[model samples]
Target: MPTKKLGVYPELLTSIEKARQLIIPEDRIRVLNPLIEYIQSKIDQGQEINLNFICTHNSRRSQFSQIWAQTAADYFGIPANCYSGGVEITAFNERAVASIKRSGFKVSAKGDANPVYYVFHSDDKEAITAFSKLFNDPINKGSQFAAVITCSHADENCPFIPGTEKRIPVRYEDPKEFDNTSEESAKYDERSLQIASEMFYVFSNVKMPA
Candidate 1:
């Protein structure tokens, strides 16, 4: 399938290109298959694809998944709406935000605590509005969506997510472990790129309807 030419900032394009080249291990591919199947099912049904990435804090992993998933879908010309949420409100981590900026996204924030961030990847597309809130927050799609658990905590603790059509676990290590350490920036960037690469893999596998 042909991809849409995105007018994203050059740096982001570079990042995306880099992500596209990274190899996804077979183990990881196995873990990501459910998400791929869910997207394909949506395409087969000619329905909108809604994915809500859930983490314990809605601060890091889930945020990364949300941004990268949406970006990848756009790149592949797949119609998908991605969102992120948590069991509790904690705010999108500044470290995670910085990592995306380093990877080539334009971001702006509003409010003080738990600010809403507008992340723009392409000039023509609307900014992805990001913030930390409950999985059932008003801003997220309430039903007919995939609940992507991005952390073991949320995946294991939150047994049931109301209104979800499927629950898929695509857990990632928390870069929070390196917070305040010298590896903070590097670790966050690593996780962000990993998520970006994986998301690109998922969308790249999706076949558009004939």
Candidate 2:
């Protein structure tokens, strides 16, 4: 089946092209298989696909996962809604935000301590609203959503997420370790593109209805 391509910002599209070229390791593919199955099952049932990427803090990894997953779904015409949350609320890190900008997303924020960010991947698409909040926050889907654990801390600590249909661990290393170092920007971008690549990989395997 042919994929339905959507319009994306030219520079972001360039990043996507690069993301598509990265090789996901076999072990990582094994880990991602469950997410693919979850999406496929939702599609097979003609149900809405909701994915909530969760981390200890809604600062970095989860945010990246949510944004990239939504983008990949859009690119593949899969109709998935993506969101991110944490066990505890902490503002989305500025470093992560900068990495996203470097990837060609246009971003705007409104707030001080914990600003809500409006991120745009395409001129025509609705902006992805990003901020620090708990996974069960009112803005997030309360039920029938897959809870994707994006960091080891959240995965282990969040043994149970109230409304998730499936809880899948897809951990990523924290770029926080590199904060304040010269490698901060590069490391954050690396993690962002890694998640982006894996997301595109997951959606690429999904088969849409005829």
Candidate 3:
């Protein structure tokens, strides 16, 4: 509900806006507008919007999506809460942490085996609680939520996510192939940056209140 503003530079906003127009389809753009308008109206009326990103694993894609979306929303002066979860429980992967750090986020170690993490960004520290069990955590509880599926498997298996106003399928390819590769670090960083850029596109074109 709090309209937190990051106040990015005007030139950056212009570039993000341009990038948004290129990434999203016109039809998909139309589909997103209704929800976007509603969200902005709620913000205008002092309500916070929430988005939940889901994948098969909590490590790479969804984690990046959630953090970047929150960052983008804040950068755009949108009142939003972004959370992430997975169908199977796994701690945030080490590759993700390293990549996130490279992208300018501060991370606090949450443990050893399946240790969680506190991904710190700007004025927001999203309580990025991850669960191995589906829908078994506090991150899934909210009145205003958008269910964003980042993987094909979870999206197919769990077609309907309870408590979400919109179940959006925005799938991303798994970056696990880079595992054990020579370019592991660079690959993870690439994946993280891709997610971040896509999320920036999402908020840039999202309808603001009229």
Candidate 4:
């Protein structure tokens, strides 16, 4: 059985909820509550969650969102599964993995070596394997999912996700520009932290107790 516990990173958990509270009069949480309720209820009924995060390139924003989502969910004891993909064909760069590692995540590369789309693990027994893969219904073994669009591009370009039961657009800035800069590590770490914060915040608000 999976558990949802607010772990050592309590401040980050609080930060996520705080950010949501600050997002504007409406940040889609209202409409999203029904979906959230449904997902949580499914968990109550012993269903596993599969989430997919999408972006234009599947390199940075979407990848970061997927990793952070799983991490945050794990931290909170939620048995949620996460995946990522992009609308365009782009390889997952080595620099991105370096950034993730630098951000204090254990990274592993598996699957094909295309560099654009590869599979990676977080090195934690419970952590989901993170990867840069194309978004497709077939990838998760015919699983209907909660689809999250992490960038404006993918959200705007691909509106209907065939296997998704819920589609949520939560755009984040591109960290790929920090690619070769001296600040690349810091910038990517910042993005990871940002994603981690929000995901944990959203997970925290789910009413069902573990």
Query: Which has the higher TM-score value, candidate number 3 or candidate number 4?
Result: 3
Model 1, span 1-210: residue lDDT tens: 337777878999899889888999999999999999999999999999999999999999999999999999998899999999999999999999999999999999999988999999989899999999999999999999999999999999999999999999999999999999999999999999999999999999999966
lDDT of 4 by residue, 1-210 (tens): 125343424443444454345442255456345546656876887777888888887877887777767766676567777788876656566676776665555445555654433332333435445555678824553466778888888888897778777787788788878778898877876776667656656676665552
Report the backbone clash tally of model 1. 0
> Least accurate stretch of 10 residues (summed lDDT) in model 1?
1-10
Which ten-residue region of model 3 has the weakest summed lDDT?
A: 127-136
Q: Tell me each candidate's TM-score.
A: 0.98, 0.98, 0.77, 0.73
Which residue pairs in candidate 4 have backbone atoms (N, alpha carbon, C) closer than 3 angstroms, thus clashing? 3-77, 4-76, 4-77, 5-76, 91-116, 92-115, 92-116
Put down candidate 2 lDDT per residue, 96-138, tens digits, no spaces: 9999999999999999999999999987689999999999999
Arrange candidates by lDDT, highest first: which order? Answer: 1, 2, 3, 4
Q: How many times do residue backbones clash in model 4?
A: 7
The lDDT leader among the candidates is: 1
lDDT of 3: 0.68
lDDT of 1: 0.95
lDDT comparing candidate 4 with the true structure: 0.65
